[model samples]
Target: MRSHEHAAIGALCGALAVTLLARGRSFLEKLALWTYGLLLSVFIDLDHFVIARAKTGSWSYLTRAVRHPVWAFTEQESVFPDVEMKLDRLASHVLIGGGLVLALRPLSRLLAVFSAVVVYAHVLADLLREIEVA
Candidate 1:
């Protein structure tokens, strides 16, 4: 899926998160949680750069994407083609989400759960997109 699609999904998840988990939070607090969730959901894909480094021994794709943020994000399929399914590894999404949730747990249960759910939602959506594309 495109980054924008992930973002739209993130936006929806953020709204749902605020509705479901932030009951009793002040408006500003709820807004903060929603924003955090959305940002987390969208940025979790940054792990792909680490994965690329491990597999390809360089950050060519990451740097290219960074250099052309708008085109890289909007034209992701063209910018980051996976003709051979080279980007199919699962560790990036799963491990990063797990690690983040573990790290955030001590700070606040709400933050931990919210991060886990948002990451899970992002991964699930990506997996579903993979399935559809395959």
Candidate 2:
């Protein structure tokens, strides 16, 4: 999914956290939930940078691709068409990231849950878009 879509999902996650999960909580709790939700939603995509580095052994290509996915997508066919897309390897899209959040929930239930929701929502949105394209 695009950045805008991830942002929308993040907003939704924050809204839900404020309205449903943090309802009746202290102001600070709600604020934390919303803020964490928004940040985690987009931050989860940082996994792509790691994946890109691991695969290509450099960060420059990942930075360029993140800045311009269309160019990268087209270039993939010309330069490395034989290579398969491995976005699915991102920790954010796999159970490891969620498990880490869940494990850390003991530190702050509200923030952890909100962060998990935003992360999973980001993954779900990307998966749905991939299915649509397929």
Candidate 3:
């Protein structure tokens, strides 16, 4: 999916968190949930940078992505298109990242649940996208 799609989903997740869990909560608690939802939604995609760095043994891919944040995922041609991009899928869209979020329940149950939902929603959107190139 595109960066705009991610942002849209992230916004929606934040809104949902505010609607479902924010009522009657303390200001800080509500703020935390809202912030987590938005951040975690797109944060899952950070696996792309990690995988690129690990496979390339260089910081160029990561730095370019960080610099051209919008173009990293939006463009058809990548700076390192030949890299093993599928590593990103295994790292984030699968069970491992979700498990990590689940583990966060010990720290804050609300954040754990909200973060899980936001991440899952991100994965669902990616899965549903029309993959013309695979």
Q: Alpha-carbon error at 111 in model 3, in Å? A: 0.9
What's the TM-score of each model vs. the native? 0.89, 0.73, 0.75
Better of 2 and 3 by TM-score: 3
Model 1 bad stretches (over 4 Å):
82-89
Q: In angstroms, how far off is 115's CA in candidate 3?
A: 0.8
Note the Cα lDDT for every prediction shown.
0.80, 0.68, 0.72
Q: Which candidate tops lDDT?
A: 1
Q: Write the per-residue lDDT of candidate 1 for residues 70-103, one digit (tens) a residue.
A: 8877786675464233345455778888999899
lDDT of 3 by residue, 3-121 (tens): 66787888887888777966788888777777767777767777776677777888898788778867876783575687866536644566755786768989977667777777777
Task: For residues 27-51, write the lDDT of model 2, one tens digit per residue.
Answer: 8877777777777776666666566
lDDT of 2 at 31: 77
TM-score of 3: 0.75
Worst 10 residues of 2 by lDDT: 76-85
Index of the highest-TM-score prediction? 1
Q: Which ten residues in a row have the lowest lDDT in candidate 1?
A: 82-91
As for TM-score, the candidate ahead, 1 or 2, is 1
Q: What CA RMSD would you report for each candidate?
A: 1.9, 4.4, 2.9
Clashing pairs in 1: none
Better of 1 and 3 by TM-score: 1
